[model samples]
Target: MGIFKKPPLRGGKRNAGVPDDLWTKCQCGELIHTLDLKQHAYVCAHCNHHFLLPGRDRIELLTDAGSFEEMDHGLYSANPLGFANYERKTADLREKTGLNDAVISGRATIDSFPVTLAVMDFKYFAGSMGSVVGEKITRAIETATREKRAVIIVSASSGARMQEGMLSLMQMAKTCGALSRHQEAALPYISILTHPTTGGVTASFATIGDINLAEPGCMIGFAGPRVIKETTHQDLPKGFQTAEFMVEHGLVDAIVDRTKMRTKLAELLSYLMPQPSLSGQETLG
Candidate 1:
């Protein structure tokens, strides 16, 4: 047989795509280096579009260094509805995202304040709120209640996982129920809404936070604009179902930037949660 060689990649030196491990485009047509994106917390410096952030990275961004101790790390999804290839698909996602489920629940400190943190990974099946995800979140909230720690849930999801049927939908109520108890104990819960928070998540624990915060331009609603328009035969208003609009209308507490999220959370925690006294004489009152 004659010796042959494989063809070289496009552009002579690299792949043809924009973000070929080197470059990406902003919404304003600005060329951004992939390294620049990481340095900027994945926010576009030109137009400031908030990009999808990975769950583990978000945990690192929000939590104190060496402070994250993950809980329920071994839990995986089960095919309660017997969806074809669901287990196989979930296993693949587990390997791909390096997460046991869509949500990563752990005990972490933000600015040295203890918190129960749960971050959802959108790369895993759109971060669907399936059985395991629901269980993990509920357990996180319950643990926070027990520890008298603040609960911070960063929600990014497509809503209930249809593959699990009613089992998935039940999570909406289950998480909320746990949260209701958490609230009764007077603990603070800060829900961070990233891009594309909708469906049951928007209607449930995600929205009922003591202070609901969202990133700029995050899409938040029960149903997306297109789905609502198609179902109701109505024209959606400008900027409808967005974090910007929600803040203006008082649905969301504030539209926070990704860069300032930790600072804002720490500030808010200072206000909502009382810090422990440092000196013994302070109790003289």
Candidate 2:
């Protein structure tokens, strides 16, 4: 009935409800371009809010270009508890996240300072620690010890994976044991706690680092404020779980923004680990 049937709107059609890919809404109620946010290391320009970076993104952000050697790249969970639909869940996450497990362990260089790093991603099952995660982290730490390189763990987890039951709990001990050996070897270990680092992670290796760093506005604790308040039956102080509060209470050594993390880590590594030369190679301590 109409001329040319309205031309069919031409080339392509976009979903009406889909949001623009270039823009993102910050938690502080600010609209920002995704590329601009990334240029700022995903920190909100308006509110200085630190946005969550993917685990692999973090590795790229902190490491020197082309200097990451990943360990246990093919490792994955085995559904040890025979949890219902666990395999499906893991497979979905693996496909979705393109990661074998929640944590990515490897050797990397920050400002060309060699170190062993394990970064947790909340995108995969909230970055919960399972047997694979535990083994991978333990192996990373052991590698650092053998190579005499500093060990760094960036945690963004809801804690241990309950789907694996005791197998998951066992990781706490296993990771801590590896850290102990790393410690006895006199190698420095740094723990960087991002938002929502809690539960069995906080109980074990998360809290036992030689230097503990937390991100601004991040919540770091074993139990959440709600659970603590319900159990204690007392009004907790304001900013109870914030990184600033943790620093004030001596739980965290310092609160560093995400933008400054790589530089700060380099500085700390340079200070704690003085090298004979300016090379990025590992030293035998």
User: Which RMSD values do the candidates have, in order?
Assistant: 4.7, 4.8
Instruction: Encode model 2's per-residue lDDT on 1-285: one tens digit a residue.
Output: 788678676555556666567789988889999889888878899999888888888998888899899999999999777899999999999999999999999988787767999999989999899999999999999999998789999999999899999999999999999999999988899999998899999899987889999999998888888899999999999988888998999989998888788989999998988653565463544
Tens digit of lDDT per residue, candidate 1, span 77-123?
88977899999998998888888788999988777677899999899
The segments of candidate 1 whose C-alpha lies over 4 angstroms from its true place after superposition are: 1-19, 277-285
Q: How does candidate 1 fare on TM-score?
A: 0.90
In candidate 2, stretches whose alpha carbon ends up further than 4 angstroms from where it belongs are 1-21, 276-285
TM-score of each prediction: 0.90, 0.91
